[model samples]
Structure formats: C-alpha cells, structure tokens
Target chain A: MTFANAGTLGALPGRRDELVAHLTRPSTALAEVGCLLYEVGVSEEHPDTVFVVELWTSAEAHRASLELPEVQESIAAARPLLSGEFGGFRFDVVGSPLRGGA
Target chain B: MTFANAGTLGALPGRRDELVAHLTRPSTALAEVGCLLYEVGVSEEHPDTVFVVELWTSAEAHRASLELPEVQESIAAARPLLSGEFGGFRFDVVGSPLRGGA
Candidate 1:
C-alpha cells in the first residue's frame, strides 16, 4: 500500500525540448538524495504537453526535494516555455490489479 | 515555477465511500505537519474507480506525510477494497494559462 503523488504538465508550443532538457539536466546532488525517479517527456496524444513522472519514498521526501536549490533552479529555467494550464491530483496506491495482469 | 507532483488512483467497487472515508479520516497530528490537501472521490467517467487528488506544499511534504503512522494505517485499511491499478506522474507547474480564464 504505497502512496503515489502524481500530476500532468502542459508545455508551451515548440518548447517541449526545452522543458525536457531542463527537467533532465545534470543532477548529481539530487541523485544522492532519496529521489526515486524523475522523468519528463512529451505526451503521445498531446505533443504540446510534456508528461512528468516522479516516485519518491514518501510525501515528505518529495516535498524536501523541492526545497533543494537544484530543483528550484530547474523549475525556474523551464517556466517561460509553458503555455496552457498544468495541474494534477495525488493519490495513494490502494491496490494494483495490473499486478494480476489486468 | 512551482513543481506539482500528481497522479490518479483506482479504487475497488462499492468501496469509493470507504476510500474517501479512509483518506478524510480525522487526524490530529497529520494536519499539524503541513500536509496541504488530501481528497478522494470517484471518477466521473469511470465510476468503478475512485479518484484521488492531493496538493502538498511540496513533494517531500507529500512523501513525509506517508511516513506517518496514521497514513500508513489508512493505506493498509484501504488496500483490500481496491480493484484496479493505481499510479500517476509528477510535473513542475511551468505556467498556468487558465489564470487568464481559459
């Protein structure tokens, strides 16, 4: 019963590359921390939007990572390129039927 | 450039109430720790699956909240009632165009 915090992001036109690059930038310090995963890429149905996925040990860990200078800097760098609204919800993984092959 | 960590979850049948109740249960300590928001409901299109949305001060805050005994116990309680898979993505809020009323 792991809790997962998740959300989707909308990117500005022609700025997908910039967004991805900013997210995937070198992060030696972030890696040293307990950040489980941080991936950013373009959406298949909506190319103008980039999908970001991250897995953290806990909500606290996720919040702490945000306070880091590196994370803040990366976000600032990626800001200008966004166009549309970006928001998402967070939920705990109560169960995963896919584990049984659904 | 606020980074929003978000995701969606699927709940078990006839258990939406249970899921929501589990998430919204009274907590004296959790509320004191700066866990921003935790909400659970059903999907409009997919009623069989419950929808969960949370807004935390930061990813770390969301993760740390999970470490609390209350969160853990709630998760364990809700586990058996779930049916399908639950997962989501996290993204940085580069910009929100809706601010202009879209």
Candidate 2:
C-alpha cells in the first residue's frame, strides 16, 4: 500500500505567490527524501489559496522527511503568510482500480 | 475565500467497509447542495484507504453538488469499490490566519 498526504495551505491575500515559492523550494527538498511526488499549485477558483499534494513511500518515510530541517524551516516560513487554516490528513493506499486491475 | 476540497479514496483490498457505506450515502446528499462540513470518519494509516474532506461555498457551489442526480448515483456506486487513484483538489480560501485575524 502506498501512503498519501493531502492538505490545503490557506494563504493570506497577497501572499499566495510568496507562500507557493517557499513551499516549492523545500518541497523540492522533500522530493529528494524518498517523497515520490510533491506538487504545489494554485486553485482554479480561489486564486489566493494554494493546494498541496504529496505521495510518499510510507507514513514513516513521510514523517522522516518532516524531521529534516529544511522541511521544518519551510513550514515556519509559511506561518506568517497564511490566512485562514491549513488542514488535511494522511492516508494509506490500500487499493487502486487502475493499478490493481480491479 | 473559503473553499477547500481535498481527496484520496484509494480503496480496494477487502473493500474498506463497503466503500465507506457508499460514500456515506451520497455524502449525506452532498450535504444539502450548499455543501459544507461533510465528514467521513474512516481512515487511519491506509486501513484499506479512504479520506475525503470538503468545505464548499463556491466553485458554483461545488459544481452544484454534482448536478444532484443523487450525486450521480453515489459516484456510480463507488466504481466497484475503488482501489488506488482517487485523487483530490479544490481550494479558494484567500486568507485565513485563523479566519483573517493574521
């Protein structure tokens, strides 16, 4: 089973671009730490907000990446630029119709 | 700004409690069309895989709650109990430092 971590980064008005840059910078770093995919993009409807999607090998691997100083720093940097709330959850990929040939 | 739609419904092995009761029965009919605060409590580290979060007020009210044919027959009856690849994305909350305070 693969692991997925999904969430939203609610950015403050005028800070969306800056926040995206911050996240993308260390998100690149996250990609190097066995994080399979890291994507940062803006919403089509809500331009001020940003969405983040990540796929990692395992929950432990995802947690391990957070331990990296770069990851921590990037999050800290985003604190001030955010607006409403940043919330999401992690999951385990137990099945996939496409991949599993269901 | 205050729109967020997150995703991850990759379930297959053993069918994950019958696809979370067929997506919580229309996600409770996509929560009366306006679509806010719909929750499905059924994921903890990939225990067969299911995670969905939605907060909607726009994007044409979550695309008019999917044109409400009983939410498209509950996503076509969860497409054969799912596995892998159910992605997620949607957002527009411009600023929220705890609801625009910061």
Among these predictions, the greatest DockQ belongs to: 2
- Over B3-96, each residue of candidate 2 has an lDDT whose tens digit, in order, gives 6666767778888778866665534555566675444434555677677655566668788888888778777888888875766676554432
| Weakest ten-residue segment in model 1 chain A by summed lDDT | A93-102
**Cα lDDT of model 2 by residue, A24-91, tens digit:** 65234565667765555577666677776566777788889888898787678778998977667776
- fnat, candidate 1? 0.03
lDDT of model 2, residue A41: 55
Candidate 1, CAPRI quality class derived from DockQ: incorrect
Candidate 1 residue-wise lDDT, B1-102, digit = tens: 233434455667677666656665666555455544444444445665665434455556666877988778878888887776776554433332112100
Docking level for model 2? incorrect
TM-score to native of every candidate shown: 0.50, 0.57
Q: Which numbered prediction scores highest in TM-score against the true structure? A: 2
Native-to-model Cα distance after best TM-score fit, residue B85 in candidate 2, in Å: 19
lDDT of 1 at B17: 60
